[model samples]
Target chain A: MSDSTPSTPRGSADPFVPAELYTQVQQFYARQMGLLDDGFPDAWADTFTEDAVFQEASRLDEPLRGRDAIRDSSRARKKRLEAEEIDFRHWLGMLDVRPQADGSLHARSYALAMRTRRGGELDIFASVVCHDRLVSVEGAWQVAERDLHHDGSGRD
Target chain B: MSDSTPSTPRGSADPFVPAELYTQVQQFYARQMGLLDDGFPDAWADTFTEDAVFQEASRLDEPLRGRDAIRDSSRARKKRLEAEEIDFRHWLGMLDVRPQADGSLHARSYALAMRTRRGGELDIFASVVCHDRLVSVEGAWQVAERDLHHDGSGRD
Candidate 1:
């Protein structure tokens, strides 16, 4: 399922992607989101590479760099959402995956964050496009860089 | 590269996506956007399958179903944008692609709509996630269904 072999450049004549590799990448994202929505920020943070870069929509002034910073932000976000009694679900869909020459995968997807308040009033809190650069580390897919572009000026 | 061969069911042990096929799929969406941004609404609408379904953010109550409706709406949108002298660019990224058992592909990506007014002052107008279902016909990939979920209650 994992391709450890050296990859050709983006324009190479042969750019085959195995079905298993695609599925594995998809599953990796699913797990990351599941952990975040299910109140496991630490686990979700672990999905990123050690030197991961995350650019969130709300915080444009400072990008979260490295795994420790990402984990801290995730933890803070989880606490804030919980304290506000907001039940949030992050739905990721419409993914396009492209394998790069450096044995990494460049993936993009749409993200919809829906929130339910105390009275069960559900609303879409955030909509953004997530651009990710992913790398395979020890047979696992980890996010190396993620740039989130928000649809509007609002919190996700 | 286009693969006319029959696709195996999802979760199959063998799911092979040729490099050329992947490139073709990416190009299809790119062409679609190019046409729209270049003020060719009719051509952009033609990128969809005959019976395509499109659910936009502003008109949630009315989902554009079929090619005719899609074309009409696109034309109208283009006219409105042009009349207002709005320079809009739809940036799509983070695409995740999955092959379905029914020989179709499910793709999702993030979209950010940026607008510049007559004064050249740019702003992020809308952020949304686009979920798409695509199929290949005559060696060309066409969008079968698209659902745009906006981040907030704002126009994109």
Candidate 2:
């Protein structure tokens, strides 16, 4: 109905490749990944949806929600992360995005993330599950609900 | 096309549902979830194609080819994990599984996992993408190629 993509893909006005969605999502993450690795924690939070709820380590908090909250939270996170040392590299793959009945999307991506602090890079494997509400806002699809799946083997 | 759902689902033989294949594949996983949780890792891996590839981690390895390798690796992993002093929960969600062009079913699942170790649970989320090759072997459907994605956040 929203012309996001076809129910059956293959034939549609929208570019309907699940892999491509990951590529677009990757672009959205560039801002945060760079900042997080550099200790600019707050800046990394800027990439979240205004009403975004970040679920991490069993502590689900609206660290930033609504347009106003996002701006303020970004600034705070950036300042806090400047002190902690971290080198995080994320290898996101095996991306799958499907169109839902309500015109929204349910996407799942595989991650092989490695974090380095002093010397060695410890591999951390995780599955990031997201339920995204996509809308044609200003001709681009932005995030809606990023329901993360903190499910997986910690060892990579 | 084949139906891979168990008889319990709403429309098991809708013609549009692909019943035979659906029942076989669906039941197999219906069995997998329980067995894997019950600690029969190798037996669980036996449901895959001989050239099966299961990459628990996103890496240069791409896909973990061969059923024997997948079985051995899964067994080894279970051995290591069962010995850890950690609270580990493996959750696999079924999103949708489609019968592919080659009759193989490509399934996408949303995964949310948490591991509590040393008084803290680092919430690691991942999106598991499975491309399964289903076959009517001895009256059942088995998996073939599974490409699990383990890194990056696929937000809206």
Alpha carbon lDDT at A68, candidate 1: 92
Q: Model 1 Cα displacement at A94 (Å)?
A: 20
Clashes of each: 21, 36
Q: Estimate each model's TM-score.
A: 0.57, 0.43
What is model 2's DockQ versus the real complex?
0.03
- DockQ for every prediction shown: 0.03, 0.03
Local error of candidate 1 at residue A25 (angstroms):
9.4
Compute the lDDT for candidate 2: 0.50
Give the number of the best model, judged by TM-score: 1
- Place model 2 in a CAPRI quality band: incorrect
Residue A10 of model 1, lDDT score: 46
Chain A TM-score across all models, in listed order: 0.83, 0.57
Off by over 4 Å in 2: A1-19, A26-32, A35-46, A61-63, A88-91, A111-115, A118-136, A149-156, B1-47, B50-156
lDDT of 2 by residue, A15-133 (tens): 23443454465455554456655655455544445566543433354433554565565566545534455555655433445566776555444444566655556646443433445
